[model samples]
Target: MSSPPAVPVTLAEIARLAGVGRAAVSNWRRRHSTFPPRIGGTDVSPHFSLADVEEWLRSNKKLGKATSREWLWPRFEALGDRNETGLAIAVVGRLLAAGEGDDGGPDDVGSGAVRAAVELGQREGPSDILTFLLRRWLDTYVRQITTTPEPLADLMADLALWVRESIEGEPREDVVTVLDPACGVGHLLAAAATAVPAALNRPAALLGCDRDPVLTALSDVRLALLPRPGTLPPMPVIASGDSLRADPLIGTQADMVLCNPPSNERDWGYEDLATDARWVHGMPPRTEPELAWVQHCLARLRPGGSAVLLLPPTVAARKAGRRIRGSLLRTGALRAVVALPPGAAAPHSVSLHLWVLRRSVAGETPSGPEELLLVDAAARFPRSETRENGPEWSELGAFIRSVVGASGGRAAGGARNGATAEDADTTAWATVVPVIDLLDDEVDLTPGRHIMSAPGHAGPRLTDSWNEVRELLDGLQTERARLAALDLTSGAADQPNATVGELLRAGALSLRSGRHPTEAVAPEPQHARIPLLTLSDLLLDGSPSGWTNPDDAVVAEPGDVVVVGIAREFSAWVHEGPPMAVGPQVHVLRADPQVLDHWFLAGSLKAPANARHAGTHASSSSRIDVRRLQVRRLSLPEQQHYSEVFRHLAAFERLVERLGIVARKLGQDLGDELAAGRLAHGK
Candidate 1:
């Protein structure tokens, strides 16, 4: 037989490969008798042979547009279930690595799973094929099986590579080795492999160890997939065993260590390894499992090498871990404590800390002048965060850079004076707290407390606030007069009214929603980038609130009526700004300029009748039924008049909002000045 066409696929997979919907695939099966029949699987989700589906798609003119990963995932799904899938993939990788070259095929592996996989190896080297397979595995199965979020792996890798350079200094010829003792699926290890070449212009030897055998096998395959430069320190080594108890790579020391070890495990070999050599900092209390992992990471690093460990916030000030924290700081091993936002990692509700550590180089002491960097990045997450999505990647990248830059100054022996709240804008958000201050009774390492005792607005004068309030009041009075002058009553004119669905059907307006073809990951703010208009931006300010790739989002044209689809209060705006993309919670209604005025449609949509029909909910996050909204149809002349009046009223409302902000700030400043006795009893 011809290898049984190894890759098995489902109807849904067929649709994805063909870049169409499942219904279309069903239609094809019913209408075209030539379509492939189900080979396996339940009645609800029937499976088909991958090769047959592709052939069918080709014969029917539909098989040439999918990404390589999309084409490979179904093949892996056909191999076996999730548990044995990784092993089956490992076997195929081993076969290709051994130079079998797809010769043995199903005869060599004794299964249908290896047939297409061997062909894949023949086409795109075994390493590349394995990388694609591993990524699919991680995206689909890793989160449900592991606690570490995928993004955190990238962050830890970046921090580790950055610290390695800081510790080793520049212009090196030797290959650097990076290790991850608790490497889960080798995320940090993969990151390190990529970062070493991109940052330091050198090859890297990646070392990883995990107690779980399956993870070890998975990590080994992933490490083999990493791209290699010119010859480095031996091939990437991943060992399976408890890294803390009997380290498989004990004699070897890595130049940098990066890890996200499991925490809160009670039986993490504490009884058998009480006096292990790794606990040179202090004997970790039995309750603090994270400290044990911390010591293991520190012990694996060579002298002057840096290690960045992601730990729970409790490790910084826990009663049991306090002694180790103080010891690490006193010896200058602990360089910085960065408090990340809650959603930065998995277990998404807990805000974790990144502890930047350096093994004690000979003759280095952090007695008095060596201040530890403490960064308050707890508020670093984007304000537009939802319960489902965590922090933004670009923002997290910026935070990591800021933390590294702040600590880099200290590591290079560059000391500077303390910055008050007045000079905060000129300096980074991090503060350098002396080691002596941290060696207090509690040994607290929370970033918010040690960094800057005062809030950002500590020094602005009441006079300045009052002047702004005065200016805003003047503008508001003028706008109020303008609002009063407009003819305010609805005209007694006969007109037909229609729902938004009717207008859509009549071709008077086109409603467009869903992602654009060229959409990409959004860029971070604080950089010069195109603004993406979110629902919050629509409801609060008339401007954009976030950044996105111009291609990844749909742009709002000048005449388009934008509606907020998820909010306690409904809002609609006519886009008058430069081209901006619509965010997730927004819908764009492009009106025919010849038939309707954009401003008039928006005003009518905002009215009580239309707003009530749009959708009402106790939770603002509930989506609005924008298509069900009603609009009043009027003569073009009447619409133009109403549009003109609505434009003036909107401008007036904006001025009033500005006036409110100024009034609130003036009240706050007045209270602060009075409390400080700066204007006691009006002098």
Candidate 2:
């Protein structure tokens, strides 16, 4: 009556499903005579049915946790061979798409995975099961094979969709066609589909082609699941083939072409297909296969339609790609080249460039036939090691606008780091480079080279630097005097106090420590990413500086006192920003306004003596037992008075910090000017 023992799983998976170690599963196999016998797989990695293992573990009181769809994926992976594994996954996807009782059409051809798929469908429902399976596959297999990182996929999709919108200029149409020649798991298509309902023209037809059959199938299923408004578009057309070798949809031309094609592919039919018509721009060199993809994408677009392709920076400047690059620039097919930060995509540490291209029609010549837009957007990426390389959407949106809004090869522009008045005429970071300048001997289209060549505001005057230095000196003296006058000496020498743990037991304050960070899981992707407050981030800028997921950890609210675990001595800081998740080595204390002051708690806890007494730890893994630290007992008014003095001391610290920054910046600028013979000590 019941399904045949689910799917056969390996000992490792059994351990995972039971939330135990592999050794525990092995011990059970040896000690428990009633344990499931090997149903399949090698002696070293024997497999057992899920139903039998579950029953045995339950009877023996060893089943530790509930099994979910995540635990089921490893069963598919245990199917023995790599190709067989992929086939099993594909069979499952096909079975899911065919609906519960439909027998899975042609692709289902009957296998262990097929039967397991049906059983999974019955247990978890087709939609939920398939979503989890695909998500797990995306996190593992797809991530391993795909060139684009998950975040870059969203970015590329948005940019491509923007180009499509710009070209398809809206009044309102019920149907729109968009295509991706090399769609990988359909991330770009899925992102584009989310924009359909609000679009003036909804995406009625989605087309894609890829060389990998498995990915092509996955892409099809992923696109099919995207929510559609009113009526669904004709089921998406996803073909399996090298899009460049032979166009699968020969007569079809999409309004927009979005592609992140494989780069640096040497065997890209360059030698065999030397006379290919797609190379209308120029004959692509053997080393520069991305240019071939660029032309292929352009060929897929309707007249005046735009295409966005993700390419390597080498495509912009490599010697072999110059001819094709020059042809694109000369024909005005290439509109803009925006450089993204390194690590923007997986497997490539070098910066990537987004080449925005448009096909010219009878009456439409690009705004600047002799010029191209080049933007150095690498500045928008965070330099912190703990942060995700996901480009900020707002910043990317600004980049899109800047690229599209520029006219006559000129647009109002300014520096990313606050431009001076003199340099306000031309844009900062983004520039419009003339074609003639780019066509020189090397034909280097790298955005940095051209964008950085534009003149910036003149260096600071010697008199101005001297005047600012003198002003800082005056303020430094004033702050020093105020620091000396602080009345900390008036505090009671013998105050009654209790340990932080004791205060917490008496309901005077609440203490919480964050989850110790591990590499086990990642936060769900977020569009408006917020910086997580790590100990290093707190120490450096006194602000949250790394990405945080709202669901993953406890967040510190405005009045919480955050403490670092491994400080040289005890250290604490009052959080001042919006609520943010605290990192591993951090703890937060929320004080009761009536009983304790946050500044007072933080100041006393950060005191050197209190820090050392908490524990004597080694230099390698130092820590502070914050609960054992003592807090002074003071009435609300007295606490408020001392808190005010603490606030002044904090301000003094900040003033000194600013003084150092200004002094260093001034000296550096002066030294540079002096080296250039633009400044002297006398005047």
Which candidate tops TM-score?
1
lDDT of each: 0.70, 0.68
Per-residue alpha-carbon lDDT of candidate 2 for residues 1-683, written as tens digits (9 for 90 to 100): 33333467778677767887677889988998888999987997687877788788888898777555645675665554444666566666666666644354343223545666658766776657666666655544432466455555555554554544544343344666778899977766675565544443465578999888878887787677566677677778899888888778767777677788887789988877799877898888889889999999888887766677888888888887788888888888887787886556644345678888878776655443777878776743433322343455555545544454442222322122122334322354667888988888788988878753222222434466567667767776776777788767676699997898999999989988976432112223333234466666555655553454443456788989988777462478788877777777788899998888899888778777787777556763578788888878788888887787677677777667777766776676556545556544675
Sequence-dependent TM-score of model 2:
0.61
CA lDDT of 652 in candidate 1? 72
The candidate that wins on lDDT is 1
* TM-score versus the correct structure, for each prediction: 0.65, 0.61
Candidate 1 on 230-328: residue-level lDDT in tens?
Answer: 655457789988887788989877788988888788888888888798888788888998999888888888877778899989888888888998888
Error of 1 at 247 (Å): 2.2
The C-alpha stretches of model 2 lying farther than 4 A from their native spots are: 1-12, 19-49, 60-67, 102-110, 122-127, 138-144, 167-173, 366-370, 385-426, 453-683
Report the CA-based lDDT of candidate 1 relative to the real structure.
0.70
